[model samples]
Target: MIADSGRSVAFTGHRTYDGTAAESLSAAVERLYGRGFRTFLSGMAVGFDLAAAEAVLTLRAAHPDVRLVAVVPFRGQEERFSPADRVRFLRAVAAADEVEVLAGGYRRGCYAVRNDFLVDRAALVVAWYDGSPGGTRYTLRRALARGREVWNLHPSGGGLAIRPVQPALF
Candidate 1:
């Protein structure tokens, strides 16, 4: 079994999130923390990954036990990123309690490797997917297949709404 498989949560979402995403994720982090979840796994991608990690760090200020784990896909993942984006990513990584690099070098499936790694180590997944097929969708499916509780924060009526994924056999 993966480490922290029971006390951990993972995050996934689209890169383009609405303005309400930060608030929505903050509330979700607090709720999960109250439920005894302390370790959070973030894929460390651009959108939801960054937002969720920041939210966790914000919450950690009040709850010292909470941890932020940055699951970087591979070495030099930020090489092609803009300077500002790279700075943001570094800040998140520096603030993380642990940084797990899934691969020593970049490969075709590095992203999938990272996503699966996060899901494998987590019991709950908090996502902000907009129903588009991609890494987020794949991670969500994997999380559900593993019987993980998934809370999807989707935009609705100009705000975010929580939709929990029902556990089902694949």
Candidate 2:
């Protein structure tokens, strides 16, 4: 069982993933599990968001105690996606142990709201960010400001870079 609500992790990344990104993501999830994080939160966006969720799901086979929570930006968030994308989104939501809708309908800065919520609820943040200007970077900054532990699999310089699995001293 989850040790506490703080024993959770959140993911943030760009829609476009770099090569070897998936492998790096899976490895990080496994390490997080080893570190006693039993809950994983995702924004349920395309690319890295879905990839991170799927990684948690795969690890779930061996780490059945873990939970996947999907945080959607708005009610009809996936309605504008292609048919295949909509199906994929639905499947991911269905796989989640819990779903959180940030708003009843789409609104300006809704994406930011979703990203902030993920960081707020988790003690650990795992992301694939290149320091580009986007939600991933914004979430990373928020996580840092909140003093959450973070691991950047693919940061600006490139390659796998994970923070030590220890609580932040601050």
Candidate 2's C-alpha runs over 4 A off are 1-3, 155-170
- Model 2 clash tally? 0
The TM-scores of all predictions, comma-separated, are 0.88, 0.86
How would you encode candidate 2's per-residue C-alpha lDDT over 1-170 as one tens digit per residue?
32365899998888876435676677788878888899999898877888888888899889789899989999998897768668878988998888999899999999999998898899989887776788887888888888888887763532223343222211
- Write down the lDDT that model 1 would get: 0.81
Over the full model, what C-alpha lDDT does candidate 2 score relative to the true structure? 0.80
**Candidate number of the best lDDT:** 1
User: Which one is best on TM-score?
Assistant: 1
- In model 1, the number of clashes is 0
Q: Tell me how far the alpha carbon of residue 25 in candidate 1 is from the true structure, in angstroms, after superposition.
A: 0.4
Tens digits of per-residue lDDT, candidate 1, 1-170, equal 23567999999887776445676678888888889899999888877788888899999999999899999999888786678668878999999999998888899999998999988899999888777778988888888788888888664221223364322210
Residue 50 CA displacement from its true place in model 1, Å: 0.6
Model 1 compared with the native: what TM-score? 0.88
